[model samples]
Structures are given as C-alpha cells and as structure tokens.
Target: MADTAFHSARQRYADLGVDVDAALSRLAGISISLHCWQGDDVTGFESSSQSLGGGIAVTGSYPGKARNPAELREDLDKALSLIPGSHRLNLHASYGEFGGVKVDRDQIDVSHFAGWIDWARSRRMGLDFNPTFFSHPLAADGFTIAHSDDGIRGFWVRHGQICRKIGAAMGAALGSPTVTNVWIPDGYKDTPVDRLAPRRRLEDSLDRIFAEPLSPAHNLDAVEPKLFGLGSESYVVGSHEFYLGYAIRRGKLMCLDAGHYHPTETIADKLTSVLMSVDRVLLHVSRGVRWDSDHVVTLNEELLAISHELVRNDLLGRVHIGMDYFDASINRVAAWVIGARNVLKSLLIALLEPTERLRQVELNRDLTARLAILEECKSLPWGAVWDEYCRRQSTPVGQSWLDEVRAYEQLVLSKR
Candidate 1:
C-alpha cells in the first residue's frame, strides 16, 4: 500500500512536470546540522554550576537531560537513528570534552574536542562549531567582543580564534569543511548613548579573530547577528546590518538565523540578495514565537518559504543548513528528530514543486496562473513522497518514530 501510494504520487507530480525521484535524491544529499546544545539546554560541561547568562534562557525543567559527554552522545545517537538521511553535528566550544580538567574558554584547543571528532568519525558525520560567548563570568555584563574594556574584549577574541582552529581540526578529521559560526551576546538592556564605540570595538575584535586564516577545505567562517536578546532588548551590538556589511566586505559567510529578526521578517526573502554579494551562506533554522525563544522548528509557512526560496534560486549547494533550537520542555532527543525531519520535509516539498512551470508562467506575466499553480501545489501528495523517502532511508515513516523515542526515554532517559 505504501509503494502503491508513492507510485500514484509520483505519477501525479510527473503530470505536473515535477520529478518525485529526483526530488527525493536531492533531499538525501542535503545534510542538516543538529545542534548538540539542545541535549543539555545549552548547559555545557565546562562547569555544572555555571549560570546560563548573556540573554540566553531555557524554560521548563524536563527530566532525562544529558549530564555529560557520554550521555549526550548516547542521546544524540538515538535521535540520529530515527532521523533519515546523512546529517552533521553542531557543537559549541563549551561542550568540549575536558575529562574533568578545567579549560577556560580562551585556553581551549583541539585537544578538548578530540573526543568529539572521534565520535563523528565513527558515525561518518561532519561537525560544525560555535564559539562559547555566553554563560560565563566574563559575559555576565551582557558584553564580550564589544565590551568597553579592552581586556574583556581580548578574552572573547582569543576564544573565537581557538574555536576556529578546533573547527578546522574536526573538518580535517571528517574530510568535510566545518563551518565555525561566531555569534556574540554583546548588547545593552537600556538604550546606549554611544553605540558607535561598541560597534567599532566589535568590528576590530572580529577582524582580529579572523586574521589567522585557515584552509577553506578545513574550515569556513561565518558571523551571525541578532536583532535583540533577552537583556539586550534595547540594543544588540551585532545587528543584522553590521554583520551583512562585514560579511560582504570581508568575504565571510553571513549566518542568517531564522529567529534573530522580528517576527514579521523572514530570512526567505533575503536569500537571493545575500547570495549575490556573499560567496556562501549559513542558516540557523529555528522557530521564534514572538521573540528569539529558539523553539523547535516546525513545517510552518516561514520554513516552507525558506525551503522554496532555496530550491528556486538553486542556492542549496552554496548554503549550509543547520538546526538551532533548545526546548527543554519535552524529550530532548524527540525535539531533535522533530525539528530535523520537519526541515527535510520542507525541503522535499520544495524540491517536488514544479518550479520550471511556475517560472514559465511568471515569464509570460501570468500572475493568475502562477498563484493558482502554487495554491494547487500545496494540496498535492507531498506527504506520500516524504513517507517513501523515509522508507528508502530505512527510518520510521509517520508517527512510528515517536514510539522509538518513547521507548528510549523509558530505557535510557528515564534512568537519568
């Protein structure tokens, strides 16, 4: 019955000038990076008592959260087992395996992340990295790179530098370039009198961090900007405009996070413009309910639009897609699988669209036909195609994956 449904769906899509097989093939090639922080609510093993500062907050205390590298990896392995296709792992510098040794952010090196590299290697997964700029004593004031004090600014800069090297090492080990994204929680709660000074400091600090160049094959650098954070409601130092200009000028990958902007603003429309200026782009896919809450991603309108734009513009190869959300209210591994599968589902739907026909209609200035076709496309048998894709990948189709998650919770997470 599943195969019969897929065959009919394929014929329907083919009638509309879409190739279901080709779409599924392309979807399999796309790898979404899963964030490791989601397993532990961004609570890295650096210090058990470390407070989650710098405008970051995780609500709801869900049990079975991973307390160490072993548990985190175990949970991650379980989540990846349910998720279809090849995927990468995204790690924060704070999540490095220190083996009970105290390694400050500035002093962290490739040795700390050697365990992670081996883990990824064993699973044949690529790894992405981020610098730990928040949840530390130095960042208590809600500033790091843009700090008024030079010594504090230097500390974060050194941290970023070391993180890049560690990212390079992981890429080398996995034979895939690792994207090391730099995002700082540098802003103020209230309106600042001198915003220019802090931005200047941030620009200089970023320049220093990226000064030591590494091979592009080993590592790719990206800068992420946020509109506002919890405490930095009044002003966020690394605003979108700042990083857009910096990325274009410096030839760096500009990371456009979905939840970093206003609720009404979507990164979907910005894809074409950014790709024209920058060589590459990185996306941190997340859902923001009225703010940058980092809720688990769903197959919502914005996510679908993002997927459509990427497919339409042929930007998938030039873009690095990664999931960035932490919802501690539910089973952590379930959240990972849900967000990842939703992202892949969106991409599959986008790929299955009759883009060429739509383009032809637009070229003829037939807006009516274009709109009609788009609306009709939504009601197509994309779900059948997705189930087929999941079956081909040997992952659970439909809600069956949830059972596995629940079973894991009973056997593994419950013990925690």
Candidate 2:
C-alpha cells in the first residue's frame, strides 16, 4: 500500500519534471556527521570535576545520560538505527578514551581516540573531530588563543595542533578524510577597548596551529566563527567576518554554524557567497530559538531554505553537512534520531524540487509561472515519498520510530 502511494506520488512529481527516485538515491549517499556530545549532554568522560565554561551551557537534567564511552556509543547506536541513510560521528577532544587515566585537553593524542577509530571502522562510519576550547580552567576567563597571557594562549595552540594530528590519524585508520574544526570561545563579556590586539593574537595563533602540512586526503581543517556566546555576549573575537576573511586568505574550509549567526540571518543566503571563494564549506546544522543556543534541529523554514539553496546551487559535493546540537531535555537518543531525520528529510525535500525547471523559468523571466509552480510544490505528496524512503531504508516510517525510541528508553536508557 505504501509502495502504491509512493508510486502515485512519484508520478505526480514526474509530471512536474522531478525524479523522486533520484532524489532518494542522492539523499542516501549524503552523510551527516552526528555530534557525539548529544548522547552525553556534552559532558565528555575526560573528568567529572570539569565544569562547563567558555560560554557553553547544557540545560535540563534528563536522566539516563551516558556516563562512559560504552554507554555513549550504545546510545548512539540506538539513535543511528532509528535514522535512515549513512551517517558519520563527530567527536570533541574531551570525548577521547583515557582508560581511567587523567588525560588533560592539551595532553590528548591520537592514542586516546584509537578506540573511536576502531569503532567507526567497524561500522564503516567516518569520524569528524573538534578541539575542546571551552570548559577548561584555562578557558574559564572566556579567552583562548587570543588571551593576553602568553601561557594560556600557547596551551590552546598546542591543543589545536594535537587535534589536527589526531584527525589525520583517524582519517588514515578509517580510510576517510577527517574534518578537524577549530572553534574557540575567545571573546569578552563586556565591551573591550582593545579588540584589535585579541584578534591579532588569534590570527597569529591560528597561523601557528595550521602551519603543519597535512594531506587533504588525511584531514581537512575548518575554522568556525560565532556571533556571540553566553559570557562573550558583548563581543566575540572570532566573528563571521573574521573567519570568512581568514578562511579565504588561508585557503581553509569555513564552518557556518546555523546557531552562530543572528536570528534574522539565515546561512542559506551565504552559501553562494562563501562558495564563490572557498573550495569547500562545512555546515553545522542546528536550531537556535533566539540566540546561539544549540537546540535540536527540525524541518523548519530556515533548514528547508538551506537545503534548497544547496540543491539549487548544485553544491551537495562541495559542502559537508554535520549536526551540532545538544538537548538533554528529552530522550537523548530521540534527539539524535529526530534531528538527523529532519536534516535528511529537508535535503530530500530540496532534492525532490524541480530546480532545473524553476531555474529555466526564472532565467526566462517568467515570474508569474515560477512563483505559481514554487507555491504549488508546497502541496505535493512529499510525505508519501519520505515514508517510502524510510521503508526502503528498513527503518520505521512517520511516528512509528517514536515507539522504538520509547522502547529503547524503557529497556536500555531506563537502566542507565
């Protein structure tokens, strides 16, 4: 019955010059990097005494949070099972396996993440990494890499170097390039008189950190910028313009996090602008209610616009999609599954659009028909096609996955 519905819907889209099957196939091939912190409330197992700092905060004290790597991986596996299509794992430096030994952020190496590589290799999943710039004693002052204190700045610089090396090692071990993203919460809570000094320091530190030559096949470097953060509301050192200019000048990938910009500014519009200068781009797909709060992703207008822009520009191959949100308010696994599915669903929706025809209409200056066709597409049977996609992937369709999450919560999460 679902197949019949999908076939009928497919024909409807075909009449509109859209190939539903091709869209599904393209969507399945695109891999989204799932953040590991979502499974454990961003509390990596590095140290229990480590307080969350650096403009980072995880609200809600939901029970059954993963306490160790084993638990976190188990929870992630459950979440991945519910989400259809291939996916990757994104890990922070704090999430490295220490084997009961005290491994500080600066001292972490590839050895600490060897187990993670093995785990990813077993599942045939790629791994992305991030340098932990927040939540450390050194970063408590809301400065890193740009701190006035030379000692503090050097410590973070070393951490970034080590992370790049580790990222390369993971890529070599897994036979897939690892994207090592560098994001620092270096800003001031209040207005600063000497903002130039900090930015200059940051530029120098980044230069030193990325000086090492690494093959792109092994690891690619990306620098992420933020508008503002909890403690850095007054001013953010790594603003969008700073990183945009730096990325273009340095020939590195620029990360545009959805929650990192102003509420009114959507990254969908910046896609073409950035892609014009950079070879590759990274997207941190997230949702922010009113600020840079890392809320779980959903199929909203902004998300759909991002997807549409990517598809409209034919940039699926030029951009790397990664999920970046941590909401401990609900079932953590459910959060992952929900966010991942929504991202894929948004891309599927974009892929199913008749972009070629729409482009031709706009090119021919047929404004009336273009507007009419685009509005008509909103009422298409996209849901039926999405349900078929889930069926084809051997995963639950629609609300059925919610039941699986509840069962997992009761049987697996409840015990934790």
Candidate 3:
C-alpha cells in the first residue's frame, strides 16, 4: 500500500512538472548539522556546578539527559539512526573531554576534542564547531569579547583563537571543512552609555582571533549575531548590522539564526540580501516563540519559506545548513529526531517545487497564476514522497520513528 501510494503521488506530482525522485535524490545529498549541546541541554562535561550565564538559559529538568560524552554519543547514535541521510555534528568548545581536569576556556586545545574527531571520522560524518563564550565566571558580568577590561576581553579572544585551530584540526582529520562560528553574548541590560567603544573593542578582538587564517577547506570562519537575550535586553553589541559589515569586509561566513531576529522578521527574507554582501552563510535553523526561545524546528511558514528561498535562489552550495534548538520539555532524543526530520521534510518540499514553472508565470507578469500555482503546490503529495524517501534510506516511515524513541527511553534513557 505504501509503494502504491507513492507511485500514485509521484504520478500526480509529475503532472504538475514536479520530479519526486529528483527531489529525494537532492534531499539525500544535503546534510543538516546536528548540534551536540541539544543532547545534554547545553550542560557540557566541563563542570557540573557551572552556571549558565551570559544571557543563556535552558529550562526544564527533563529526565534522561546525557550527563557525559559517552551517553550523549549513545543518544546521538540512536537519533542519527532514525534520521535519514548523512549529516554533520556541531560541537561547542565546552563539550571537549577534559578528563575531569580544570581546563579553562583559554587553555583548551585540540587534544581535548580528539575523541570527537575520532568518533566523527569513524562514522564517516563531518563536524562543525563553536566557541562557547557564555556560562563561565569570566562571562558572569554579561560580557566577554566586548568587555571594557582588556584582560577579560583578551581571555575570550584566546578561547576563540584556540577554537578555530581545533575546528581546523577536526576538518583536516575528517576531510570536510568545519564552520567555526563565534557568537558572544556581549550586551547590557540597560542602554549602554558608550556602545561605540565596545563595538571597537569587539572588532579588535575578532581581528586578533581570526588573524591566524587557515585554509577554507579546513576551517570556515563565521560570526553569529543576536538581537537580544535574557540580560542583554536593551543592547546586543553584535547586532545584525555589526556582523553583516564585518562579514562583508572580512570575507567570513555570516550565520543567520532564525530565532535571533524579531518575531515579525524572518531569516528567509534576509538570505538573498545577506548573501549579496557575504561570500557564504551559515544558517542556524530554529523556531522562535516571540523571542529567541530556541524551540524545535517545525514545518511552518517561516521554515518552508527559508527552505524555498534556498532552493529557488540556488544558494544551497553557498549556505551551510545547521539546526540550533534545545527543547528539554520532552525526550531529548525525540526532540533531535523531530527537529531534524522537519528540517529535511522542509527541504524536500522545497526541492519538489516546480520552480521553473512558477518563475515563468511570474516572468510573464501573471500575478494571478503565480499565486494560484503556489497555493495548489502546497496540497500536492509531498508527504507521500517523504515516506518513500524514508523507505529508501532504511529509516522509519512516518510516526513509527516515535515508537523507536519511546522504546529507547524505556530501555536506555529511563536508566540514565
């Protein structure tokens, strides 16, 4: 019955000039980087008593959270098994294996992440990296790179410099370029008296941090911007404009996080504009609830629009797709599967679009036909094509993946 349904759907799509098979083929080639912090709720193995500061917070005490790297890897393995296609793993600087030793952010080395490199290489997966600038004593006052004190700012600078080298090492070892992103939660609760000084300091800090350039094949540098956070409600130093100019001038990749912008603003609209200035982009796909709540990715209007923008504009190669969310309210592994599958599903729907036909209608200035075709395209058999994709990938078809997660929770996560 499944095969029959898929065949019928394929024919139906073909009638509309949509190639279902081609869409599945393209979707399989694209990889969405899965964030490691989500598995452990941003609580790295570095310290148990470390407080989440610098405008970062993870709510909910969901049981079965991965307490160690081993457990996190175990849970990731299960999540990856359920998710189709090859994907990359995104790791933070704090998640390195320090062997219970006191390794400060500045003191971290590639040696700490050797285990991760080996694990990713063994699985034939690529890796991405981020410098954790939050949740530390140095960052307690809600500043790091842009701190007024040079000593404190320099400390964070060293961390970023070291993280880039570690990212390069991972990429060199895995034969894939690692996008090492820098996102500092440097801001003030109230309106800053002098935002210019901090911005200048940040620019200098970043210049020093990225001075030792590595090959793009080994490490691609990216800077992520946030509008505001918990304590940084009034002013976020690294606003969108700050990084957009920096990226354009420095030739670095700009990371557009979905939840980083205002509720009314969507990253989809900014892709074409940002790409015009920056050479490449790194997307941190997430669903925002009024603010940067970091909710799980859903197949909503924004997600579909983002996916469509990438597909229609032919910017997939120039953009590094990744997911950024931490929903601890539910099963952690299930959250991973849900977000990843939705991301893939969105991409599949985008790829299955009759872009040429739509463009042709728009080129003829037929607004009526363009709107009509877009609405009709939404009702097509995209879900059937997605099920066929899962079947081909040897993954669970539809909600059956949830059953695997429930069973794993009983056998593994429950014990944890």
Candidate 4:
C-alpha cells in the first residue's frame, strides 16, 4: 500500500544487507497539518507543494479540521470518519467554527474534545493541534496578548488556558505525545520602543501554561514560529523559537517548522541547532516552499526520495512529516494519503543515500551537522542540558516586535 517508488530503495537495500527493518521502525512518529475543518479545502495545497519539494517532511492525516463552537462533536465525527482506517491524525488546526475567532468557550459546551480522545483510543491514532485565531482582526496584534486595548489585550491568555486544558487531557490519551502547537500570526511592520514591558507579561503568561504539572504522556509541546516580509519595518518573526526555552518555567520542547522562516532565512537548521544547543529539541519536522509557509510541499518523487534519505541519516527524533497546506481542491482523505505516501517514500529513498551522508553536512537550518552534535551529547540527557537551553531560550519579548504593530495601529487611529 505504500508508494512503490518509496519502497524500491528499501527493497534494493534489503538485497544489499543494509538493515531495512531498523530504518522503518525508526521512522515512526509522523505528523501532518490539516486546514480542512477551518473552512479551507486545503486538499490540493499539499498536492501542489509535494510536486516541488519531492515530498520531504510530511506524514499522517492532517485533515485540516477546525473546531466550531456550535458542533465540535459533529465536526469531530465527520473528521474522524474521514481519516482512513490506516493512518493517524496529527497537527489539527483550530479555525473556530462558523467564522468566530478562536475556539468559542460558549460554543464548546458539549465535550467534542472528548470525542477526539475516544477516536484516538478507538483506532490507536495520534493527534496534534495548532491553535489559530482568525475573524478577530486583533489577532494581528499577535503575542502581545498584553495589549491593553479594549478588544485586543488578553486574547493569548484566553486561548492559552484552552491549550493548557487540552494539553492535560491529551497527555492522558494513548499514542498522542504531541498535544500542543502554538503559532503566532501577529507579525508587525514598524518598530516600537517600549517592548520589554509587554514581553515580560507574555512570557509569564506562557510559563503558567507550560508549568501546569505535566501528565507525562503528553510530552512534546509544538512551538512553530514564522517570518513575514514586504513590511515597512522589522517584526518578531523567528526569535521566539529559542526564547521559549528560557521562558518555559516548566520543562518544554521546541518544534522546528520547516515553512515558518523567511525566503532568505532558511531557518530549519538554525532553529533546530539553537534548540538542540540548549537541548529543548523535542521534535523535528517541516513543510512548505523553501521560502514561506505556503504550506504546499513539493510533490516531486525525487525530492521526496531525497528528503527521506536525509531523515534516515540525520537520526531525527519522531519523523512527523505531512503537508502544511491550506487550500481546497482534493478530498481530505486523498490529500492526506498522498502526503503520507510522499513522506514515507522520501524516507525510503533516504535509506538509499550512502552511509557517509554526514560528511556532506552544510551549515543549513535543517541542522544536518547538529544531529551529530546531539549524538555526541550522549553523556548528557535532557535532564543534563535543559538548564542550558532554558538560559539561551530566555529572551524577553522586546517592544520592537510590538513597535511594528504600534506604529501601524497609531497611523490607523490617526486616520480615523
């Protein structure tokens, strides 16, 4: 049932005595990003991108399911029904139902959240959720959840509490290690002067969420940061990835999203290396064009094959590869299957690469060399390097990120 080409390399290696069994087992933890339930078809998004990346890092059923306040359970059943019997669910995007911004606590009366747990338990599936706030123009305010404006301030906390609660419940589920995903869309264009004041408040709020006594089962906290350009000034795009390490009062790990960096930035290796250097590197995965979070991954077979080779050689922990696409055209089920196959195939091809793939390490963000760096840290487990990571990750949110927004907002108010 796996892609024939994806398997060809493995079969060939089997003929050559390259330990195929070990490779497949090592590639277990695959996850995907779904934007379907959020009202975006997102079906063709992956199809289009996979054509380019050759299907590098993508796996699992990213149904693109969004939770609606009115019928969370209804949508849950519909999405669960859509996931083919074979695959697992990962990276669920919460695009508040009926076009309300964020998950409406008012509409979440019935425990649709419970159904996902039951669904995973029933089919032995895994689920990863990303909290998204749309419909609220203020979301552009981004992480400065500290904004004291009438309708803007505190969105982060309101939504944050929900994430923490979900994390607790998800940690209790079987086969679901990655329970939380945080991505801030508030990118600013101008610079602000007084940023530290707000940054501290945001960090403290985040601490409250992560410090909630962990359930252990819920292990990976997915931290995906993105960058935006074509702006009048600089915005806090990629800096927060490492800042998380220090701010997490409770232990937490960072997830390096492949598409979140700017075009020239190519941050996969940089973020991963930074996280690894400090030791908050819990998971490694990616999607999108090399430049932006277009979410569409290259569908080229050769590319997928090559990426697979990288994963095999890199020793990446939990390969949750799946398309981070959000558009409509293909069936959710088909898109998921296609994306999954591309990722699986890519891994197979990676095995075909010469064993010395490590020798070719370039200073890229995918952290090709850092895998070796991590390998050398055998003497120091996470308990060993957590403090160091925390120290490096402890960047306080500066007003600069906010300054970008403040300048724009002030201009808008002046015009009004």
Candidate 5:
C-alpha cells in the first residue's frame, strides 16, 4: 500500500476499534539511559531525574588491554562533548576469575584508579564502582568463596574492605552521587559442592557495606544481579530479584539487570510494576536472548519488546542502564558503540509507539505502525527520535584519564 493507503488503513482500524493517538501519547513519556565514554565530569545524577553514564574499561581491570586511568578520563572528556548533561561513571576496577579467588587487587593499577576517583571528586560526579573480575581467569572458572577454605575467606574479606574504603571515600567526597555497583561472578558448578562458607563470606561482606562509618558520602549501594555465569551454581547471586522485600526491610536498595532474566521473564513490565517497591535500582541491560548469553548485542525485536515494556511501565526513574559486556576479542569502542546505539534506538521504539495502550500485546503491532507516524509528521526532524529516546538519566561522570597515563605501582606493598 502507498503511504496514504497505509495511513488510511490504520485509520480504518482505529475508526472501528483502536484509540491509536491516546496509546501513542502515553508511551511517548518513556525514556532510558545510554553509556558512552565519559564526556566530562558532571556528577549529581538523580535516578528520578533519569541520568546517563560513561566509562572506559568495564570488563578488564589491569592496564594491558584496558585503557589506563588517564586515557579513560580523556576518553570521557571527549565523550562529554557528545554526552552532555550526563553524570554517572562506572569506574574500571579489577576482580578475580569466577569461583577463583579474587586477585590481589593491590597488584592491580593504582594511580589511574585513584585518579578516576580524584577526577570524580574534583568534578563532583557520581562513581559506579565496578571492579573488574573477568571470568576468564583461573579464579573465575566456577570457583567461589563458598568453596574456598577459611583462609581464602579471610583474604577475600581483607581485599573487599580495601576496595570499600576507597569507594566510601570517593562517595563521601562526591556526596549523594556515589553508586557502588557490585556484581560478583560467583556461583557453583553441576557437581555437589560446599555452600555454607561462601554464603557466609558473601553475607558477612555485604553486611559490612551498611555497617558503621556510614561514609555519608557513599550511602548508595546498588547490588546488581545477573544469571548466566554463576546462577547455574549459586542460587543467590546479588538476590535483587529474590530479596527485594528483604532488602527493603533492611533499608538498602535493589539493583535489577534487564538482560539478566531468562527469555520467559517479562522483566520490563515487572520492573515497572516493582520499581516503586525498592529503595533504589541500578539497571544492567543489554541485547540478548534473555535465556542465552548476555553480553551487549544490538537491540533487536526480542530486546525491544522488553524495552517497550520498560517504557510503558514507567521504570526509568531510579534506574541506570549498564553495558554489561566482556569480549576480549573485539575493540572496546566497538562494544561501546553497539551498546549505545541499541539503547538509543530502543527508546525511539518505545516513543514511537502509540502511548495509550502500551501492553506488549499491542506494542509489536503499534511500533511497526508508528514508524510511519513518525515519518509522516513532516515538520519533525529525525533528531526528534534521539531526543525521545535518551531517557532521563543521572548526572554525567566524565574525567580525563589523560594526565595519569604513565603512573603505575604495586598497591599491595603500598599498604605497607
């Protein structure tokens, strides 16, 4: 059918049964956050305000394949040009392999790490502390604190404290803009395994997060959860979905990852329905089958369905989307672009929908129809799509990793 013919057809359907404009307008209000290289330092992002985030290294901790602090900060500086008004930064930190003992975080890069903190401090940006613990290492391959000996538990706690201390200080200096996002690749294997010790260890460590010395600076702790890696072994990974009512009872926040669910889970609608019940939400989203592998991928039909559900449900507040990816084989920036564009487009799909009846049952049909609506609204610029999509986000956390490039040292001995 011709454009006119198509419009007429849509009108004919509406003339009999649907209220397209009302539905489309209702969905127009939905929005989401997109990650990028930190463009500049601009913390103070309010979840209610719908903020954005930027980062350099999300998967790797060390400097070898990762961007040093200075380089990351610089990349963020440039990212700021494109991502102004954004203020959330996911700090690149190191972690141990799955099930394996978390590495000597002390041995990891320090100067750049601290530099990123200092940058956040100076620029007044919020830092989503994400220490990298790739699953590729011996420690990550199905090993976890649960299976470790008492001695290993001691070692892990000590390391956790050090990272927490730094994290608290950064949060305090930045005030209300701290986001300590912790996602451990911890779980069990198919075989029978010890569980008590790891459960105790993780529980004990988590309690410390809310303990005394409140770090008034870093009071926000977004415990993010994912399934594919360790959920196979451990039943209690992050427990955001499992422990929402419990965490609320404890006065802590709950972080939910959109991509962490199996395909059967209607995450978006559930999130919208549940957003009000939690203390806070730290969003970890990506394009995937929901039942299969979940690194960042281009947001496709399956992904959009949930995203649109996220829109209709109104869960953009108290939520920040993360690009949870780990592909050592690809250029990091390529990964970044893929994540960014997908998020932006997902939002457009949501907006283009007839805002009225946003239930998924109708969204698929409406989205296909709305593209024509957008194109036909002749005076509107294509850029309107971008504006409609970049959901409200937290403040921007951009920094200059440039100045700290040459800095390096052993954090272990420094403690001495």
Candidate 6:
C-alpha cells in the first residue's frame, strides 16, 4: 500500500515536471551537521566547573542528560540511527576529552580531541568545530577575542588558532572538509562609550587567528554574528554587518545562524545576497522564540523558505547546512531526532518544487500564474514521497520513529 501510494504520488509530481527520484537522490547526498551540545545540555565534560553563560542559556532540567563522552556518544548513536540521512557531528572545544586533567580553552590541542576523531572515523562521519568562547573564567564578562585587555584577547586568539588546526586535522583524517566557525559573545551590557575600539581589536584578533593558511579541502573558516543575547542586550560586537564585510574581505565562509537575526528577519533572503560576495556559506538552522531561545526546529514556513531559496537558486553546493538548536524540555535525544528530521523534510519538499516552471512564469511577467502554481504546490502529495524516502533509507516511516525513541527512553534513558 505504501509503495502504491508513492507510485501514485510520483506520477502526480511527474505531471508537474518534477522528478521525485532525483529529489530523493539529491537529499541523500546532503548532510546536516548535528550539534553535540544538545545531548548534554551544553555542559561539556571539562574538569573545570564553568557555568553556562555568555548571553545564552539552556532551559529545562530534562533527565538522562548525557553525563560524559561515552554516554553522549551512546545517545548520539541512537539519535543518528533514527534520523533518515547521513550527517556530521559538530563539536565545541569544551567537549574535548581531558583524562581527569584540566585543559583550558587556549591550551586545547588535537590530542584532546583524538578520541573524537577516532569515534567519528569509526562512524564514517565528518566533524565540524567551534572555538568555545564562553563559560570560561576569562569570558565571564561576556567578552572574548574582543576584550579590552591584551592578555585576555590574546588568549582567545590562541584558542581560535589551535581550533582551526584541530578542525583541519579532523577533515584530513575523515576525507571531508571541516568547517571551523568562530562566534564570540563579546559585547556590553549597557551601551558602551566607545564601540569602535572593540571592533578594531576584534578585527585584528581575527586577522592574527586566521593568519596561517590551510587547505580549503581540509578546513574552512567561518565567522558567525548575532543580534543580541542575555548579558549583551545593549550591544553586540559581532553584528551581521561586521561579519558580512569581514567575510567578504577575508574570503571566508559567513555563518548566518537562523536565530541570530531579528524575529521578523530570516536568513533565507540573505542567502543570494551573501553568496554574491562570499564563495560559500555555513548555515546554523535554528528556531528562536522572540529571542535566541534555541528551540528545536520544526517544519515551519521560515524553514520551508530557507529550503526553497537553496533549491530555487541552486545554492546547495555552496551552502553547508547544519542544525543549531537545544531544547531540553522534552527527551534530549528526541529533540535531536525531531529537529534533524524536520530539516531534512524541508529540504525534500524544496527539492520536489517545480522551481523552473515557476521561474519561467515569473520571468514571462505572468504573476498570476506564478502565484497560482506556488499555492497549488501546497496541496501536492509530498508526504507520500517522504514516507517512501524513509522506507528506502531503512528508517522508520513516520510517527513510527517516535515509538523507537520511546522504547529507547524506557530501556536506556530511563536507566541513565
């Protein structure tokens, strides 16, 4: 019955000049990098006790949060098994395994992440990295890489330098380029008297951090921007304009996090414009409720629009997609599965869009026809095709995945 439904849906799409099989094929190739912090509520396995700060907070006291690297990996394995496509793991410098020894952010080396590399290698998955700029004593004032103190700023610069090398090493070992992104929480709680000095220091710090040239195949660098956060409500140093101009001038990937903009603004529209100046982009797909709350992603209109822009403009090759949400209110592993599956679902729907036909209508000044086709596509049988995709991938075909998660919770998470 499922096969029959898919076949009927395939023909329905075929009539509209859309290729179902091709869409599925392309989706299979796209990998969304899942953040590891979601599993443990951002409490990394560091010997030093650093409270979660830096203008961001994780809510909910969900039970069974992974306590250590082993448990985190175990939880990640279960979540990965449930998700439908191949994906990469995004790691923070703070997550490095330090065998009962204290390894500060600046002192972190690839040796610290050797276990992670082997783990990723065994799973045949690539790794992406971020320099942890928060939750440390040095970053307590909500400033890193842009601190007024030279020593504090240099410490973060060294951290960034070492992180890029670690990212490059992971990429070279795994035969995939690792995108090492930099996002700082530097800003003022109250409006600063002089904003110009901090930005100048930040630019200089970034220049020194990225001074060493590395192969793009091994490691790609990206700079992320934000609108505001808890502590830095008045001012944020790394605004979108700052990073956009820097990315353009430095020839690096610009990371446009979905939740890093105003509630009314969406990163979907920024894709085409950013791509004109930068060669590549790194997207942190997230959902923000009024602020950067980091809610789990769902099949929302903004998500659909993002996928549509990627597919319509044919920008998949140039854009590296990654999930960036942490909702610990529900089951932690389930949050991962839900957000990842929805991201893939949005991409699949966009893939099934008859973009060229709509483009032809719009180019020919047929606005009515264009709008009609767009509205008509909403009622298309995309769900049947999604089920077929799940079946073909040997993943659970729908809400059946929820059952597996429930079983895991009862058997595994409950004990933890």
TM-score of candidate 4 on Cα atoms, chains taken together:
0.61
Q: Which stretches of candidate 6 lie over 4 Å from their true place?
A: none
Candidate 2 vs candidate 5: the lDDT winner is 2
lDDT for each candidate structure: 0.94, 0.92, 0.93, 0.43, 0.47, 0.93
Q: Model 6: per-residue lDDT, tens digit, 357-391?
A: 99999999999999999999999999999999998
lDDT of 1 by residue, 101-209 (tens): 8888999999888889999999999999999999999999999999989899999999999999999998999999999999999998999999899999999999999
Shift of residue 242 alpha carbon in model 1, Å: 0.3
User: Which residue segments of model 1 deviate by more than 4 Å?
Assistant: none
The 10 consecutive residues of candidate 6 with the worst lDDT sum are 47-56
Against the hidden true structure, what lDDT does model 1 obtain?
0.94
How far is 238's C-alpha from truth in model 5 (Å)?
A: 4.9
| CA RMSD, predictions in order | 0.7, 0.8, 0.7, 15.5, 11.3, 0.9
What TM-score fits each model? 0.99, 0.99, 0.99, 0.61, 0.61, 0.99
Could you give the candidate ranking by lDDT, starting with the highest?
1, 3, 6, 2, 5, 4
Q: Write the per-residue lDDT of candidate 3 for residues 1-416, one digit (tens) a residue.
A: 99999999999989888888888889999999999989988989898776577787888888999988899999999999999999999999999999989999999999999999999999999999999999999999999999999899989999999999999999999999999999999999998899898899999999999999699989999999999988999999999999999999999999999999999999999999999988899999999997665998888999999999999999999999999999888899999999999999999999988999999999999999999999998998889999999999999999999999999999999997
Clashes (candidate 1): 0
Q: Model 1, residue 12: displacement in angstroms? A: 0.4
What is candidate 5's lDDT per residue for 1-416, written digit by digit as tens?
23454355446436434443443343333222333322211111111131222111233323223233344454454433333234456664441111232335434333335656677667656666654333222344443333365554444444445555556666666674455555566664453355455556666665653455555356456555555443353454344443465456565556666656666664565666566676456666664453444465576665576566666556555565555544434433334444655665565555444455334425677775555553453222323333322323221222222222222212221121
lDDT of 3 at 130: 96
The residue ranges of model 3 lying beyond 4 angstroms of the native Cα positions read none
Q: What local lDDT score does residue 257 receive in model 4, on the 0 to 100 scale?
A: 54
Off by over 4 Å in 2: none
The ten-residue window of minimal lDDT in model 4 covers 47-56
